[model samples]
Target: MSVAMKGLRNHITPVSKIIITSRSKNIATFGTTEALQLDFLPKEAFWYFFKTIAFGSSNPEEEPKLAAVCMEIAVLMNGSFIGAHVIGGILRSNLSGQFWYTFLEYYRYFTGWYIHLQGEHQSDMFKKRSGLTYIWSYKNWSAVTATFHLYQISSANLNDLPVIRTSELLTRDIKLEGKFDALEWRSSVPPYYSYMVHHEYGTGNNHDVITAIESISFTIDRYYRQHQGVEENLRKLHRMLLRIQAIVEEAHGRQITNQAMLLQLRMVRAVMYRGYYFLDNFRYRTVQAHAQDEVGDRSLGLSPFSQFKRFCFSTRTRKIASEVLDQKELQKMLGHLENIVSDMQEFVAFVSCYPRMSRQPYCSYLLLENCMFGRQIEQEKIINFLLEPNHPSAKGINVLPIIGPGRVGKSTLVEHVCHDERVRKYFSMIVLCSADSIGGGFLTDTGLIKHRNPTSTGQSLVIIELADDDMDDRTWTRILHNLRGEHITPVSKIILTSRSDKIRAFGTTEALHLDFLPKEAFWYFFKTIAFGSRNPEEEPKLASICMEIATLVKGSFMATHVIGGILRSNLSAQFWCRFLKCFRHYTDMHISVLGEHPSDAYTKTSGLTYIWTSRNMSVVAATYSLHQASSAQLADLSPILSNDVLTGDVEPPEKFDALEWRSSIPPYYNYISHYEILAQPPDMLPKRKRSRSLSEGLV
Candidate 1:
């Protein structure tokens, strides 16, 4: 640790002084300051504890030691937490999660910190001493707070926690005692708000709790909850600033930066993330309450509300700090905040587009493209597969499962069909919902409770499924549970889409297994996106472009989309000739666009994200160009995927991959979390599991 940090640490630790209680009744079980400290409390024990966890490893034979260390750390943290509870202390820093994570039981696996950054502080010692120690920092305070809140927020359905405002010390069973069951629940929960992004609010107080609850509630109630999740996280951040503003005012009151003021700030920061979870448990069904939603059926005991609260808090924090705050001290904070919001938005939007990716998924995806549907034999085959002749539920008109790999356009096809005017008018209420899978970002707007059943009595309901399939069976089971009505209350039309053939295999009814778009249609879609509105008649060269597209696509929708996006975006007759030449070169290691290299073109242009703003999408859009590739492809295309790609308020790059990207799906790492549906290829699903996560190891 640097001398400054060491000095800071020493000053931050509270030293207990004797404060004899006025009377016995008030003394109670815990003492004043001394009572606040845990057994064998060491002022700087946390730093050592973290260093051991981050830098040390354990052997199986040493399991007891690891367990002991974990328990000790937990004890120390619980003490700190209780200590804060008594005095209502502030957090140690703007970054809040580091402390709370010890008890949350999420990071018992592997987690560490890195700090080799420069802030224009060029001194050699600054790099050496200041950079030697790495920590989780204040960025992930929201996620930590969320994990902690899991115990509280999930108690909503409990016979306990009768009211939102409870001052009495809360006590309940929040432990995950078994070998991996507890961790499994923790694993399934979203860590969208990680330790890297969130900074701290000094005081762990009632206001932040309220803000955290509001954020989580906003996320839970809103469809496409991930976006709201981010928004709430941003709010927590703004609240964090509010805490800082208060602290600065307090310090300014004294007109000094003395030891007293510094200690006060650390104390305030400590408490901010302390009971930060109090509000996380506010809006949703508590773990104690029966989920009554889809997830409730599968993992019955754990709560995801904690992570949800954290995510909501982190998202809100970064947003308002950039959008509204103009404090001079926060000048650079403004820039960083804006970047965080942009990245997070891109991250959120990308995750939502995963569902509804099948050829017949647009209806399920919620895109009403006015498409036409056909294919009888495939549909029948799906029905047969869904309900085998021997299965008990095989007697009636059964629901069939539609299955494919991730990013395959399953949801898109379903969405397209559902949105068809015929289908739209066919069902009294066509509800397209998502079952957001583990580790994925928020995709569709539909939750298990609110969005699934929209049709009234005597009306037909078409239930289009998305991400909810992973951990939810209630929504689907509800379909069966609701079907035995005596009066035929409502005609239920159900379509299920999932990457898991296991889940799809269980669905029985009319099923259509999506394959890649046919060659002719691929050509049409590719040419349409590539050559749009520009007359093939006016530019006779379109014939050659069309032939080139057909050859490259080769009956693959993905290939067509990727090539078409490129061709249409670079639509000048001259650009087409060069584009064709460039395509040939990629096959032959050739470089095409002259006067500017391809890399330079990526740099000089507004970047692909802005291609949507271009009036003439043909020869100038990104979405139209690569219609079938996953957003993961775009994330890989970053640096080139600049800010303009987000809001699309700017002009596109010259020779851009043109196609107005109406789809809100941004690229995300996890395929399942998309709001729409996965349009994965036939063999891709198994391979993803076989392969290592590309982003996890290095990044």
Candidate 2:
């Protein structure tokens, strides 16, 4: 081989131009890479520490001479590793005609592919870098050994160089670069999760265990990292990470970090960069353009005899025969170069398939994903609410109520329900939100809010919102039109609110008035908020104040939120004061609106905003029965007044539309309603007269 390498001074083939250098020697002994200028390194430093291991350098300053000799002898015990002497069935089959014919005869034409696998080369070592747990044999020990030696030497200064022996390269001062342990890598070893990176960046390849030389590559090093103590092997692993950082930064343009993915991904990206650079920067992924006479360490295949020269001697040229060839010859060489590129791309794609086979991040967060369904009351209510619309029994037993004062939670309840995946999947899509609620997650500008991120243009949408009387009707109509576009699903439903009877003019969807909770549920729910438990006895007075507010809550989600905020504040007197004030405000607002008694007016007009005919008053009389209604009006009114239960033909009250929105009501409370207040005192129409008028109109 040495004689063959030396004889390479003659022939000048064009192949020599492609590879710049091919490191052949175990180059690490050169040590303290600081000896070389930083410019000597390649780009792609953003990866983690340890991806910078190059095979060996070309003799850059030397004149064109015989190239360095890199003899890669991989052992294939069974086609898996180089020779450990166990011929696995796959290799045994390869030993026959097909394998021998394909590789030995044909693959040699492909530079890196056809090498001697039949030969026996055996050398064993405690995988120094892979953790002492491994004992790797020389399957392709020559290249592996050379690589390890080169990096080991480069890492150490001249004073720290390891001596190479016939069988093994050993040093009293042990320093192992993790990148060389191929055995530590294989399929069975647990793969390391490269640290998280911004969502846009990801590692495209798995680490080649033998070649992965950074902190993120192995578990042992990471474990060593968590603690600083030196427990022999554990200590060594930690130091390996530090060295990896140095080489990766100094040699490759990588930024290693604990963030996980940066290291390995950088290396893979570098690999791609190299192919691109080769094909582009110098046409390396292609065939060489220069004549064989061109000298350098990488021109290993050019000389008829320089087959022995490797990357080690690929730097400066020593042209023996400067006489150039003609154009016809150049064309022939170019054709061959094109073929090589075709072969190389195939090889790169083959390596690319492995990583896709290994990703499982999507399905791993099962526990965390289920956290949204936490509270018992919340769960039941949401579920029942979802089922109400479709259930046959739900028609008469329906639950619809706008539980809010000004800015209460009625709309929020609707929003949460719509966003829930279960609810999202339940209906093709349901209209659970109101118009007053404008902001949503994936909406486009100009009110074109789409329900899903990657929605198929025709997917259903559930629009929820909260509206105020001040907002013009035109705005709500436009919002509805936008919601109905093909970009969103059909008009599942529409819910609106107004303080005046005229507002009933815009009732677009089936309206259900929302009233406050019953005193019992309120007692339990309020106690939990005010005293942090369902035990009302813990703070009876506070619970009492809350129950009273619940009656005033009038099914107002916003009011509950305000009261919830008050209780959460932990101030006793202030809470009572706020409570009393809220009731007073409710009373004052009522007086200023209707004539201080809504039920009297309810008997006159079944609807809050419109002038109900004598017929409408008959329906209103059935539901109100001449009593002042609290938030619990519906629940309070449900069992009583058998004949005329305001199952009227009119819409939900204009003043209290929040109570009517469907999606806002929780499921468990299948029934809730908030009849509009008249703001007028009870009228004194003779009972007999009022009864006669209502009955006559009904007839």
* Prediction-by-prediction clash tally: 122, 111
Best by lDDT: 1
lDDT of 1 by residue, 393-468 (tens): 6433355567765445666555444443334443444444443321122222232221223342333333445453
The weakest ten consecutive residues by lDDT in model 1 span 178-187
Q: Weakest 10 consecutive residues, lDDT, candidate 2?
A: 316-325
RMSD of 2: 34.9
Question: Candidate 2: where are CA atoms >4 Å away?
Answer: 1-410, 426-450, 453-457, 462-510, 541-699
Q: Model 2, residue 656: displacement in angstroms? A: 28
lDDT of 2 by residue, 620-667 (tens): 221221222334554544432211122222443423322221122233
Alpha-carbon runs more than 4 Å astray in model 1: 1-397, 420-428, 434-491, 535-540, 553-566, 587-660, 664-699
